[model samples]
Target: MELTPEYYDKGEYIETDTGNKVSRKSVIHGSQNIILGGKTIIQTGTVVRGDLRRSGTAHAVVIAIGKYALLASRSVVRPPSKVYKSIFSYYPIKIGDFVHIGEGSIVEAAQIGSYVQIGKNCVIGRFAIIKDCTKILDNTVIAPNCIVPSFSVYGGSPGALIEELPECWSQVMEKNAKIYYSMFTPK
Candidate 1:
């Protein structure tokens, strides 16, 4: 099989000992506010905004991505923001292990649980809490404060629950994410 230039793209990322590959081209604002677990891949053109801090907290974390998580190319992962009683604040984005966020998607959710698969061009709104083992189909627009349950497939504008996931969904996500993480080579 012929691989694309992206696959062979060397010297464009910083690979840690735990196999976390973060692209040099990706924009990570306030790196101190971002915590990445092991084996996480942040692809080229991905933007992680951590400069938006919470109210009254100078050193608050903005994005906490879990182990074996993959942030695909051109995706933007930002903390969710809201106005509370005339006060504006940004909440942390907590993504669990084995999560795959597809290309061009914008994630502004408060929490995304383990084994979640978010497809391309999706919009995860502010304060949306996505439970474990959920699959979000392509082009879906999840509204603010939506609580997505576990083992379900969510899609479409406003993000309705479309179907139920199989019991082994977590295993499947783990397998695929591991494979993807292993495919990256050191530049």
Candidate 2:
């Protein structure tokens, strides 16, 4: 897919040495605990919560987003938290390379694999595992503790496997993600 150019005010963003572009308007808490793996774009109004952590852990990574990932405007990326053995702790969120999270989505997934595309206004439930090369359509609500398989398409409330993707899905997703990144320009 080819994305149109998205223009932004140069002063509204900061480009890191590794080519990650982060919007100043984004709310990123505990920045030291969040890692962007170069060439990622964090758009305006996005909230990345890295402040929530396991009790007694002083310096732990809460969110790790991989290279060429895109977090669209108004999206929220938060670590999933749960009570286990009477202990409540927030687990880390691992987003893989070439992933694209669409606008207004809220993600609290344990792991999101590479080359995945999550459409607008989606809710990824806590501790949900989304495998590689999958697509979650817009307005979908994934159930907690769900495991989405690789090369599948999921949609609707309590997101179910809609269909299986072709072998070329990975290549297509990768290409689209790169194009989207390249087209996000300062004007």
Candidate 3:
């Protein structure tokens, strides 16, 4: 069920002592979970759950995002649940640090690593592991539970593993070694 952007009204702002700015128009509280819609800007330390949506499916909400991770405008993330169609679906989603999830992509039970760029309209299924520094092009379907190695470029449904990566494969970062922080760091 695709709800139009206008359905969600933007309110003042959920401000706090720190700097978490949650949009008033967004769904921060409900009968079950705190449902967020367009114009909804949830900040750090915020948690929402009501098991909203009409999927006849099970959904699980999780607290995600790194200390400095920014969930871009119009990005919808909730708990892990299977999105049956492109029309409307959100799931257990864990977006890592410095990740860029492009437009209108649907995800379920997916763990996107740091520095990962999932292009527009990606169908990342349950149990999918998008490793660090990987660039998934537009309209790709990463099947359920797929384990992608770090620094790879995937561009097809059922996914095709190739070696077309940026130059972060051989370099190293001094402080954080697990993620691809600097351009010189290897995956």
lDDT for each candidate structure: 0.89, 0.94, 0.52
lDDT of 3 at 142: 85
Report the number of clashing residue pairs per model: 1, 0, 18
Instruction: Return the top candidate by TM-score.
Output: 2
**Per-residue alpha-carbon lDDT of candidate 1 for residues 3-93, written as tens digits (9 for 90 to 100):** 2323636688888897788899999998889998999989899999989887565677788999999899999999988888999888788
Question: TM-score, each model?
Answer: 0.93, 0.97, 0.55
Model 1 bad stretches (over 4 Å): 1-6, 55-58
Model 2 per-residue lDDT at 72:
92
Query: Residue by residue across 66-154, what tens digits does model 2's lDDT show?
Result: 99999999999999999999988899999999999999999999999999999999999999999999999999999989999999999
TM-score of 1: 0.93
RMSD of each: 2.5, 1.0, 10.7
